[model samples]
Target chain A: EKWASTAPRIASTRLALHHFDTSYSLRLGALWPSVRAGLLCEQKYGALLNNFAAADHVPQELEPLNAADFVSEASQKAQQWQRGAAVGAVARGCQEGSGEGRTVMQAEMMAQAEMMAQAEMSPPLGASISSKIKCYTFPRGDITRFRPARPDSLGLLDYYLMDAASLLPVLALNVQPGDFVLDLCAAPGGKTLALLQTGFCGHLAANDISISRTKRLYQILHSYVPREVRDTVSVTSYDGRDWDQVKGGTFHKGAGAGSVLLQVLVDVPCTTDRHSATEEDNNIFHKRRTKERQMLPMLQLQLLMAGILAAKPGAEVVYSTCSLSPLQNECVVERALDIAEAQFNISIHVEDLSHFRTLFQETFSFFSDCRLGELVLPHLTANFGPMYFCKLRRM
Target chain B: RALLPARALPAGPGPCPRRGCGEAAALRAAGFSQEQARRLLALQPRLGPEQREAAAAQLLLLGLSAEAALALLERSPALLRLPTERLRERAEELRRLGLDGGRLERAVRRSPQLLHVPRKRLRAAVRLLRERCLFTAEQLREVLGTCPAVLQEEPRTLHHQFQYAYFRMGVQQKEMVKARLFQTPFAELRNRHIFLERRGLYETPHKGQTQISNPKLKDILQLPEEDFLASLAYSTPEEYEVFKKLLAREEEEKEEEDVDALYT
Candidate 1:
């Protein structure tokens, strides 16, 4: 009876084991080697271990798929974000560049057109660029031209040295055809260039104390001014202050040459605070301070007195400085008034620049309500040095 | 026992840092103490009495601890001669007066009148009281208090004084009732002459033929209609209206002519 019971139990156990092995074999056939080994071990237990192992491998394979999906999603989101940012950046850049760029382009185009028109109107003097002087127009309707000189290299250097702000305002205010203009402290010839550009002057007398500076001025005038205007302009090397003693007779003789002595520009020596960026570190502040403290005010007053003597009665005298100091600005004006006394009454009126507030504020102290002249403070405006100007009409 | 003289002992031959030390030493040799020599140095530097006293105290402190104090004294010699507080106060006062103390001190050393009492007194007084005193309404009223007395005086004298004062103050009368009196031609004439001239306009001339200056047509036309034209010139209302419109057009054209001409 005991043997019979044991035999039945063993047969049942063997059948159950066979059933587990069949399930595992099917499961492991679809799996990789790693999964197959794990499933094979599970078959020995004669339980559902093979089924569990196959299920575990399913999750393992799905994990990498989930990771891949996550990576793809992240990359797509980043690309979309970058595209939006790029659009915003491009729109901002276009908005900023458009207005200023358009104005500059238009001005350049107008200048070129004016030059072409002048060339067509005038007779062809020669094939040389210098032979036919060209007119270049500004946005404000002011026209100028470059006159080329012999030994053109020197002329080019002088042209590069010219500062437009120092010359343009005086040109705009004073240039009249057949008018005699005296640029008292004319050196490097920037103002002379503008004066010649107007084609209005009967004579433009450019004077400087230094011979070398006068040579440079002459070279520049010859290079940029047309031959007709170049003949009219005379460059002289003489102390402007002592011009009364030196050139008094010559000036009187020139007066009869249809020269209506109407305008004089007194661009006196001043503290070079505007050119401080170009100066060496140790010398910059000290140099300006010395000029501001001692030398400039005296030189300015003397030059202004000389200008008054040289100026024809009822002539418009423009006093200018590339300095921000009050001593050089209104104080000098006040001193001139004092020196003039009631004998030669002169009135000062300021030009308006309300459209250029940033420019106005930078070149002048905001506290100054002196509309008597324009102060072009470079700090407030575009990149420029501080400049002060006053125009007076001698009574 | 022999008494040794301090001068007989050898002293350092290094040059004195104080300005005018040789002069001070010569004065001292004639009979002066170290304090007197120091005072002389202060005088050379043009230090004020207050500055000199403060400087003495600073010098005493430095000399008592010479080794540690020399470096700082060398950097700022002014520190050895003046107390920091007094110097700071002086500097502040100079700044308020729109002057730099260092520059002023240097100037004073060169020329002693820089600290003359009268100049300093006036400057200080102006700074303390009158510098920013913009006249109030009450003050202006005080200035104008004797207007009635002025008006009651001889009209000529009163007018002369008024003209003198006005010219002195650089005042120009934009509007005035008696404009002819202020006119340049009539300016030199007295009020009596002006009164006589006004009275003479009503009086008749005692001559066979009285000459009268003829007025321009434009001036005669500009006269008020009631004064010269209402009774004599116009018989009809239409004529008057037509004349008024013509006058307006003439005035407009005159203004336009004025506009086109350059100021120069």
Candidate 2:
């Protein structure tokens, strides 16, 4: 009854419901309820992979499952609704080249480390990132009756649904095919519609400082790009720490740095823990947004020093965040590499994406509990994550 | 509209995409979350009463007032993320206050001047920059975020410009806040610290920390009095026009020795 005679409104509604479990269990010590409840049951029951880059000559290791395809019958009803996707497909079919079928499924998963398929997502993250993304997934295997919010439920649909670990910071920007890229907090634009479904960028801009999330990132890059990679993108909204790559820069102007590459991404803004452990309406644990939650690590270190001061000098940059918070991921890349070498004299580093976290540890759970970035952490059947990525180059 | 559905987003705080306005129920009762109250109402776009009278004529060129800058954005929306240059070089002071459209977040948008009494004049100029300019609550939050215009002066003219830069220019509080030294004009920082203490080329940094070759107080309050009389008091402009007429006769004999010690 009014929370037991309103003792100061039940300590101000249990201090806004233990302010997101007292801020990520004080920025995740004891990985908040042990490895943050298996990365919040893979953002509540996974499946947001959609790639179909016009189904990029469809192949995806052409249906390779065999351990007698996990004794079929639709993988025993997806292993009676996932028995650790049949012990993570008998641990990626004992990392496909049986060392006695991964020492007898690692001694029957360390003699039943007590199962719910030991809180799914992570076959001990394939012993930690053999490395890390790209544009697509079906030759009809990860299955899709198409519905993550029905992209016109199918007709001339194509695909996007996203979160294949937020496509590893735009597949750790290997965007070669004549690169220019630049996403820079591009709004709602799923990595500028998966960096124009890797029809290899050559010139893309995107940007967003919210003119209505740059008109919902121009209605998701004009509804999941195409018209010749949406006529080499150009959208803008500015105010990303006064964007300007270098003296009126936008796309590797008058190209050179050993023949042009430029990329960028920067995906900042954090404390999203799946929109703060399931929305309390802008809940930065609302004790009137405790100084905007200690000024979200200096606004993700000034939008990663405005995407490394709009990089161009050997640019590659990646910097992602959904935040499990090591003060918004490795101290905002160690205070943006000491404010990009003491106030923009410019110099950047950090590249080993650990083989892109051992090539998306059979579709993500990553955690090496960060030093300079690579986080994923979501579980219960690989539900794409509490993602935190990192990669930088600019010298 | 990638064919909508992340639980149907249009919850609106911008372009009323189906009500839920009233500033997203006053930013979800000031905790924010109809998606950070629609990205803090799409970083404030409402202004139209002619862009809140041209953002109160661009916050009257930073001297405030077009109705006390629309009554301090209806009394302190956390001075919309302060940092108005004096925090020195935050991306070159937000690119010189993003040419007018920013006195750091378009003036203000209603937050809480710590529940009113006009924050007792910014908590009496941040408790006189933490007890008579000793500063440090992280240098009074980088001196109220790089000079929140010393909250409209007059607390005895900001205690006579923090007592002539902390007692007759012995300067400290980290070189009067890394020489933003109240943006020069406590009568041109006491006519450039009495023209470098009448060209014996200055000393004052006492209290036994001994050492005052003096000059770089941002080159004696940001150069130009002909580069502070040729390279910081090496002296010229005809000996700075004979030390501004002997410092205007020692400031008219200290206001005639405070009216002859107030009538002997």
Candidate 3:
């Protein structure tokens, strides 16, 4: 009904009905054109193409089929799509343009060899706390094929732009390398280009209260840095809960008197799953998941209380989001760790990113969700994302 | 914005609809923002308005800034359906590989799939690192500016990763381009250099003498196999997963004796 529950059986029934007129428009708010005219009705396109060719044998209560289970599952997927187009027109001889490009490159190499045999049937690394968090997945075949697909396009000796699961809350914000970090809603800036590719930040402010997404985060920190490592970066637009009164004074008065504001990230703004309120093109899937996801958890607990009041009393903020929504990730990091421990008396600490999974080795994959942090999800890991992050400390 | 759907836009933007004008006033007079030129012309609506003024005048004739070509097409929207004479022939083949002009616009703003790969797969990975990993063209331009996905690999898998780091870990092609060893994964650098050359903690350097103690291929491809088993294989992660399943059953019995010596 809601286009038989949010499409995604990895595209095909004619490109998932042309990604339901460009990525599921109006993501069902105002019953999206009566659910796109009951999914392009011609008597419900043979029970919505046999419920998306038995989207891996349905049942996540997507409910609705029964006219004898849609005429016996559309004649058993029209006899397995006529035995895969008669073994691809007898292995390409009846040349209907190289038999429909060898049946769409043999159904995209049998869906990438059944998603690499379901990522080699998961469940292995034991002694469980989610087997001490290992999900890596970048290029993962041919060794993260020289990584950099923009996280401010690598330079200062390719430090770390991110997505080996956003380098586990920048290795749980143990940032140090002249530490001063802050990101706080830093637009499209992949975690402030992974905290200025860690070339020992002695200062990095970055913000994004949208002056056109902080001019696309100062053209991703002047495209892969260097102008003296982008003159120790600053780029702002404020309103990260009035970033310590727009840096006028005393946010733990400059790195002294028991220093603070070392690392921050916050990374809020959510209801994401990268458009798919049916991307037929995109009206930003009902303006970012239904009318700007109803005040996204009070603006994600006011940017995790302006990244725990621009940290200092014992810095390290992290927070993060991409949103699969546990009320925008663990009820906004458990009400910003009970308002940074009872209305800023502070003394914080959360840690347990599976005790730094043997110091971030098997390229990090942590999902034991919300006792504070960790989650990567994308159908339980592969190309590591749908982030969530967590980690705090400021005792 | 009641989520528009009168047959959701196909031909709209042409006649000034309000707020900024044509091609959103030529992308807000070249520095975007009329909502980042209407969210990068609504994420490439087959880039009309004269292909977004010839892809922002071919990214200001490849010197960027028109807000860094609308922040590199808001971080590579498949480089605006490519073809600006194949983005000026992949920026003149990354300035004939010595990467000129701000290191070829920071390697095409950090990998715009290194300008849609294929130019004979970046000249067969720069002719397998200059004729079989002998490197030195300024050590393969500092290993293609510290790993530009080794110009999209496969010149016989970068000549079997430089013949397994120059003949089974005798290394040195400037220590395999300062141990970025074409960014690891010739089966996890032959299962961590044959599990530290079968635990005698490495050796192999001959002919130029110095035959025993070894380690640095950048600490065996950047450590963390549980800190290379608590600092150099004093071992355990269940004895390095039973020495990576006995070196993957001795590479499937040496690829079944080279397919039984190419069929006897």
Candidate 4:
């Protein structure tokens, strides 16, 4: 603290100088007294500290209880504080180890050595850093997939179906039981079915931008969900970018919608790069859609930002896309973060999906180096995706 | 064996004949020329009657030749004013981390500044290397012996380097130290790596896959550009040059990919 202004300059100089001393520049070019005098004297702090010119950080003071007794739970922390703060580390620890008495300077040297050996045992820096998602999954199912036994009164036309990879974003959304939910781009409604299948969704407002797409979504929801379960859903046709203008940032769950946070999902449109490469009919890579292809990431970013603004604090919004482009996936999520934090003053945290990754480990080829979310890469046998999903918690 | 040489001094140059002459005599007795003692004092003139021999003796005992020791002292005169006990204490701190006498000599010689490290920082650095970087004590000794200045870096930067090597490059600690990964700036390393990656010459290591064909970390970092291109990276300098420019532009146009995605 004393040399705070000149500390940087002194440190640089120290690097250039070997055996260079700092008694003068440090402002305390004085002799240190033996431990007995230094610790017992009124100026013990000065005597104790002056020996090391570079001792800028001192150990934090101990808690009263830790000082009195080190509980097993807090002992590790207490021990560290003791070694650094002991001022007389040599006085107590050294006395017990070696019977022969030594000079205070000897005591200090031994104490430093002992402290360092102990330091080697402390947790390493990145050791605590783990993968954002845990994984391994690929389930193969043919016509014989089992369904829950239905009650006699209600009958649905058919079961709605989709690829297992398409449902990852729904899993990433972490929709809890009885939570109000919104599926922003619910067209063709595959992910919405996955959301409903979990049996955790209470009331969901499944939406799509075009009336035509919403018509298809209604058909899918009707074919799969019985009337009793379908009553909880309200299918709407509104541009995903301006969803908050319609919902007014609050999802009214039947009657009790008071300030509860809503779980939101936006499977934004993206370049189906792999499919576009293989298919000739209505491919995004076709010359007619060049402008639309280029504009996809921007539209996705807008939809995601709206999702963030439409939710209350603690509400989670998942953004997924069928795209391999880093530009479309990671880049879009990053822009939403910047735009939300800048314009709306809303902040978002990208949650770790290690748990989801582990649950589906064998099925998806998880892409590494994705900062905001997880990407399911396409494997020939496990050809489920180019699906990218990122979960953001509004804060 | 100190890496930084003690600056050579003129044979005889003193403003005055004999004033506080004991320190000058002590250096002369320790094998420095009379002019060397004068210049060494010019660097740090604080060595006193009691401190002069002990300070000179400390360097000699660390296996430093009088010439190398004098060069270091000339480079950093502050060593003269440092208390004898502090030097012993700092040396012991490094020694405990596996920088035995020979390794310690090499590390100090390479980075004379290592001698000035605060005991707090040294402890933190060692702990971080072992715990965060996952370097075993033996690998740490090797790292210190080569790039002792790493101890002076912030923990975040050090951890980033380790992660890039471990997860991104799929390199083990032994290879990382042997490649002297810490010696190169991360930007330069990233440029080279991305160039190779984009050219389809390198694959990022991921779990549950065999990536045994990628070039060794040592060959990637230690080889000359021509050799690196000719053998491991398998690309022309022109292509590598173009890629580096594109990489820089790509990096600038977006958020930094290096920033930790993991929320704290």
Point to the candidate with the largest DockQ: 4
Candidate 2 local lDDT, B55-122, one digit each (tens): 33334445443444445654543334443332122323322323123443332222223212244565
DockQ of 2: 0.00
TM-score of each: 0.34, 0.21, 0.22, 0.39
- The interface root-mean-square deviations, each candidate in sequence, come to 58.1, 34.0, 24.8, 30.7
Q: In terms of TM-score, which candidate is strongest?
A: 4
**C-alpha local distance difference test of each model:** 0.44, 0.57, 0.59, 0.63
lDDT of 4 by residue, A1-395 (tens): 87575334323212211111221113212211111111111110000111112222211222221211111212334344345544444455656566445566566667565444433333221121112111112132101222322222234432232445676687567666678888889998877776776666788889898898888888766656767778889898888888878775345434254644588998988766444533455556555566887798889988988888777788999989876567788888898898888898888888776434533544445665577688765432234566788889998
User: Which ten residues in a row are the worst by lDDT in model 3 chain B?
Assistant: B11-20
lDDT tens digits by residue: candidate 3, B138-207: 9888788777777977788888888878877777799788887877778888887766654435656767
Give model 4's share of reference contacts. 0.00
**For model 3, what is the alpha-carbon lDDT of residue A304?**
82
Higher-scoring candidate on DockQ, 2 or 4: 4
Misplaced by over 4 Å in model 3 are A1-136, A139-166, A171-191, A194-219, A222-310, A314-350, A355-392, B1-200, B205-264
Deviation in Å, model 1, residue A122 alpha carbon: 35
Per-residue error at B86 for model 4, in Å? 99
State residue A70's C-alpha deviation in candidate 4, in Å.
Answer: 47
Chain A vs native chain A, TM-score per candidate: 0.53, 0.29, 0.25, 0.61
Deviation (Å) of B160 in candidate 4: 57
Q: Is the docking of candidate 4 incorrect, acceptable, medium or high quality?
A: incorrect
